[model samples]
Target: MRALGSNQAADPPRYNATTDLLERNLVAGRAERPYLVREGRTWTYEEVVEATDAAGSGLLGLGLDVGDRVLVATRDRVEFVFAFWGAIKAGLVPVPVASGLSAADVHFLLSDSEARGAVCDGASASAVLPATRRSDVPCVLVGGSVSGEGALTWEEVCGRPASLRAAPTTEDDVALWLYTSGTTGLPKAAMHRHRHLRAAPSALSRQVIAMEPDDVVLSVSKMFFAYGLGNSVYLPAAAGAAVVVDDAPVVPGRVEGLLNRARPTLLFGVPAFFDGLSRLEEARLPDSIRMVISAGEALAEDLFARFRDRFGLPPLDGLGSTEALHHVTSNRPHDVLPGSAGRPLDGYEARVLDPDQQQVAEGESGELWIRGPTTFAGYWRRPELTARTYSGDWMRTGDLVRMVEGRLFCEGRLDDLVKLGGVWVAPGEIEEVLRGHPGVAEAAVVTSDDGSGVPVLVAFVRREPEWDGSDLPAELRRSCRRRLAAFKVPKSFEVVSELPRTPTGKLKRFVLREQPSTRP
Candidate 1:
């Protein structure tokens, strides 16, 4: 949990005003206004300018040219911000790699991007080691000392003067490359331009978030991901607000303590953390919190309702992806449906299409396609994937959804739909029913086969604190049978302490499938 001030000054005539995205209002912003906070210290907008300038100048001193890819492997702390903006200011392409990437994934990114340099903290340092050993480059280290061959300390990265000009770059120049969340396989890098940063804050930040100058933004999701990058860096900077960064493991009690201490006005987290937080014992939200944003996965209706009842505000649920940059569809404060995914933000368009590629009706579920200024140019070095997924302005999202008379209802992924008794079933429907039960704290439904050719629906349940496993499985089964059709009911229920989850709180169904059967 470190606070890294990220403010810079205007570059020379070679640099256009737009190229210096962060330096747009360094002088205009209130000098004493807090721009960053960690633990007990705070950095003003003016102080951030010095730190940011120092980082950029230091990188330039390393003899790296413009457009050379620099790998940014750090957490949600100041070092991450410094390296990210520093490389951008120096007219270099910064690849913001995920913190939890494995050795193979790290090798793929470094080799694919052809990175010239790297900056990382303790968490990501180990992964970078093998990559550097194979490619031999300058590496800047943060947090703690690591015995490494190519590693340079953070102080070395900022050892230069506190004044440096941003490189002269056009709007279409490569700005950053965001690697996709690697739940499986080698992650693809989504290439974005210098101008792509504008659409996210304008549509999602202004129209949907309604971020104010006084707001203090806090995010449970780390900054490496596209969703976290927008809320943590883009939105907060655009609104002249402060950002709170914490790299610790996210838990209900730990999050509660941070909230009470920081008292952030805007809170952003995934559905998994929100569900747990809502069910915490004697949980009380901070008075300063005005909004809570849910994304990454579908937000369950039960968790949403319980959270709304506990806290006086309905969580602003939205849908976004690594390729889309940030949020595309979001719910506003005045208009929010309990289960619906809400409408797309201004400047973004969403169209649902059937298997034939023809458009579908508002209420009929179809594969989602989106087109907007925020969409990335394409995946790096993946022309076939790029061609298959993107066509002109529209990108096939691979998500199944229905507008349902103006409100969006996500019907899981296109592949998540399963066949049961000669009928197609969406796991969301059964999961929704299970979540409605008082004993259920969290639930997920997936199809599996037990050596018989026939596929059966299996339900995984995590019971709430108030209820033990006693009779809960039967109770949940009975509840689902009463509400849903007989064919849609789960074949068996497995009560467990927790479900398999990714680092970002997303469920890893592929991993769950490998576990031994708990069948009775």
Candidate 2:
């Protein structure tokens, strides 16, 4: 029996995101290479290393230590990166909050994470950090007035010596906490370890995106989101590729301008981003972008086909979560699928499970379960949620999915199903059919209770200019009916001038549902 399988198992890999993340690029004689570009300013790998060291030393000077959680809230991507790496180097866990979060939301995150310190940009100080009642927690302001506020300024933080002591850490050490997008409810912090940081980038940078050192990446997803964090930070760092930094909200015109300036080989965004860009009605694809990535929401089939028609390549629609640290499954450049999430990356296993947690048969839709090295350790301080979501080594992803021919297709959230006229209807199915209509640019479906409190389906849509709301709502309902079961057809369709979406491009369905009524 081949000596009983050699009588031993293989050892696990070792890595630390802090000390060793970008070091490979440095050691490979690429230290002098441009690692990042922003506002016409480029930083070499060596320069970033020095700044990271200085920032780490400054944080240490602020009296933070190992195991402390430091909340970093900043609009400056450069400053955010420095703080992120610096906190880890100082043996601290970095909590990166979205810059767009409301002050109350930011405060709740800080308080919930039990953070010992905060680093905020001066512009965001007023909104991100109020008068904290926790006197022990220091608020360090960057690009703002730090005087008398008891906050250390950016100038002071980077004033330390570049040659600073690097903290010793193990693969199991906590590196950072990414807050959930909160599309469902209040945001919760998802903690990831140093080793977890190394997993996704490996499969994504080297295998999926096939990152070349000369490749430039422009990501609309900010570092606060796991998708952004992996693409903007880990993917580039591990692959020795350069990235363009812009913390501004992703507008189509702005995105085009970024493309003209950055000349990136790869562009990253979410579903709504591509939808907005497609609405720009440009007949041609951006000249310089070789690839495009879409995540954060289901990539509608119509949007995908339209994008591919112009771009010459299908927009790689991937399904990732804050809990998984990034994309556990994604489309490969060679294996393009319009609306599918592609296959699981190396070192990850994915399955579809029914309500009973039993594995669903092929071609059946159910909740997605993923087991991977990149799976987050747990949600911070929510033991019950953690228990409900994680089973032993498997993490329960809230998104529902269907598998066909070894490809994974996201079907929106399992909870998004609507019971219409005593039958279950997937809003995603109706939305997909409606979006295929030439008159509809985008469509979002939500359920409202009927007279008896039986949930009824409603659609909020953004119509194409040609349609101009000229009886298009009726056409959309007809389209849904022709393609869907009677129960799946929306009871009502309202043409919203604009459908609400989060900054990261997730449709704000909860906001739509909270409306007094889903009506004209």
Candidate 3:
């Protein structure tokens, strides 16, 4: 890991300040390199530019205009990138809808975003078709079998022209709308401008990762998510580097294989992925990997130590949200303080503030507030939410953190803070301690009812295969009693096979709270 510094030169305004910037880079031959890879097939930047132009022309031919939203629900492939860039070329706002979403959830996103069109892969085309049809949005099927009417083939659309007029857009024009799962059940669409596209590469990429033009970057997440979109796609493109996209599920074995084959200089993944990869003690990775970035969830110290021991590099932990587009603060390899998210990157400012919005003293936990170029304009069509979250230019990240020596250490989410015996306790602290237990493979703590209808701290644990669960509950309670306040210890423990998690690997605490307790 490298230290975050201000040595990188300022990025040119042509990178993403305007809608036509990509076209200019293409014509100037500055973007002529391999941009996408799939099953040994590589698409050069020139080819990608040409494909985007044709796809943009196709969308324009369909009469889509600037600011019109196009929903994209597809697998990770070269075509997905083509459609993404193509929508930008056409001046259309592309909104990514996750394929794993339920049919009802999909419908809500399509209706809420008011998308005029959608593109989906074969596996999910059937499910997406009905939602699009109900919303009267035109559908285009990409990889899967498409027998539906009023649907266009992805191949046919990208073969139109090599030159399409770019949509005229300013720095404030919304370039993309990303929907993230919210605590309240429905997802929220965070609107990002063309200028926000430059945030990751500008602030974190060159400064922290120090990715060179020849470096290959690999991300475990998909491009649809902000984490993957910026780290995997935009960062490499902005730096004239290469990106390796594997259109497969991000399993531990597959991730190892990608590292072996691509020999990526940088790798980005969530904590769960790192934990899974750490399980394979015999798996050897290429020495070319210079940095490993962890985000989307708190990185446990145990996982961090295990990863460092195996890979000989500290996992650079960072905290980010969809509203901020990507990470606002990150721990660089050399300056990483175990369990700290590191100091704010260049051009960004962060502070811990109390509920009254007053800045807290150092080492005192408070809500994390951030101000930077990467922050999204607002949630799409939700003025109230925008007003509540955005104070002036600062974004109120619901997360709580404590600052020490200019580094931010995550405490937990405001929502995750529970009142036990009239004292607030962070579940993350308990979970972190439980993660250190030899018998525990994974753990999630949530406040729930005990059959008596009284609130209590309940812990769900995934024990190691060799651990005996019959006496595990008592053992865990005894461990907690010795290490934690009596009231803060869990009232009950439920040994589960696996804890439910989001696609990005964040523990779904809400799901755990809803689980039926075995204790009466």
Query: Candidates' TM-scores?
Result: 0.92, 0.93, 0.94
Pairs of residues clashing in candidate 1: 4-78, 7-49
Give the per-residue lDDT of model 2 (tens digit) for 44-94. 888888888888777777777776787887764787887787777777788
Model 3 steric clash total: 2
Ranking of predictions according to TM-score: 3, 2, 1
Which candidate, 1 or 2, has the higher TM-score?
2
Query: After superposing candidate 2, which stretches have Cα over 4 Å from the reference?
Result: 1-15, 131-136, 282-287, 518-520
Runs of candidate 1 exceeding 4 Å displacement = 1-20, 420-422
Candidate 3's TM-score: 0.94
lDDT of 2 at 406: 78
Judge candidate 3 at residue 182 and give its lDDT. Answer: 65
375 in model 2: Cα distance from truth in Å?
Answer: 0.6
